[model samples]
Target: MPYVNIKVTDESVNAEQKRQLIEGATHLLVTVLNKDPATTHVVIDLVPTDNWGVSGKSVTRLRQQQVKEAIQAQAERRAQEQ
Candidate 1:
């Protein structure tokens, strides 16, 4: 039996997408390694954005900061063009 663990942000995933992820992971094992689909287990761990971090900041905070910087850059570019 083969087991796979997939981790994603909880707020970014839905039921259908989760189902697809499980299916795809299982299929990959079945196709590549010739593992039995029935015996393969795919587990998804949805961690809260606050629990996932990079550069000492949470994923949610990083995303917000990126959007803010993008908007600010766009505004600055427009001002320069005008």
Candidate 2:
């Protein structure tokens, strides 16, 4: 038996996407490793952005920081152009 675990942020995925992911993962194992689809298990775990961390900050925080940086950069470009 082969088990595959896939983790994705819970913010954007929908039911159809999840179904595709499960099917795709199973197909990958069947095609690449010649594993039987009947015996392959694919698990999808969705973690909240606040619960998922990177560089000591939550994913939500990271995204906010990125947005702030992008806005600041855009302002800087406008200032330079003026």
Candidate 3:
């Protein structure tokens, strides 16, 4: 039996997408490793943004920083065009 675990942020993933993921994972293992589809297991874990970290900052904070930077860049561009 083959097992696959997929982790993603809790960003409202619907049922159809989850189904596709499971099917795709199963197909990949079957195609690449010659594993049996019936015996393959695929699990998806949804983690909160605050729980996932990168470069010593949580994803939530990183996303906030990205938005702030985008707004600043837009303001700078508009100022230059005027």
Task: Give the candidate number with the greatest TM-score.
Answer: 3
Q: Least accurate stretch of 10 residues (summed lDDT) in model 2?
A: 6-15
Candidate 1 structure lDDT: 0.94
Positional deviation of 42 in candidate 1, in angstroms?
0.9
True-vs-predicted CA distance for residue 76, candidate 3, Å? 1.1
Better of 1 and 3 by TM-score: 3
Give candidates' CA RMSD values in order.
1.2, 1.3, 1.0
Q: Which stretches in model 2 have alpha-carbon errors above 4 Å?
A: none
Report the alpha-carbon TM-score of model 3 versus the true structure.
0.92
Error of 3 at 68 (Å): 0.5
Task: Write model 2 residue lDDT over 1-82, tens digit each, in one string.
Answer: 7999999888889999999999999999999999999999999999999999989999999999999999999999999999
Tens-place lDDT digits, model 3, residues 1-82: 9999999998789999999999999999999999999999999999999999989999999999999999999999999999
lDDT (C-alpha, whole model) for all candidates: 0.94, 0.95, 0.97
Clashes of each: 0, 0, 0
Q: How close is candidate 1 to the true structure, as a TM-score?
A: 0.89
Candidate 1 has its poorest 10 consecutive residues by lDDT at 7-16
Using all chains and alpha carbons, the TM-scores for the candidates as numbered come to: 0.89, 0.88, 0.92
C-alpha positional error of residue 77 in candidate 2 after TM-score superposition, expressed in Å: 1.6
RMSD of 1: 1.2
* Clashes by residue pair, model 1: none
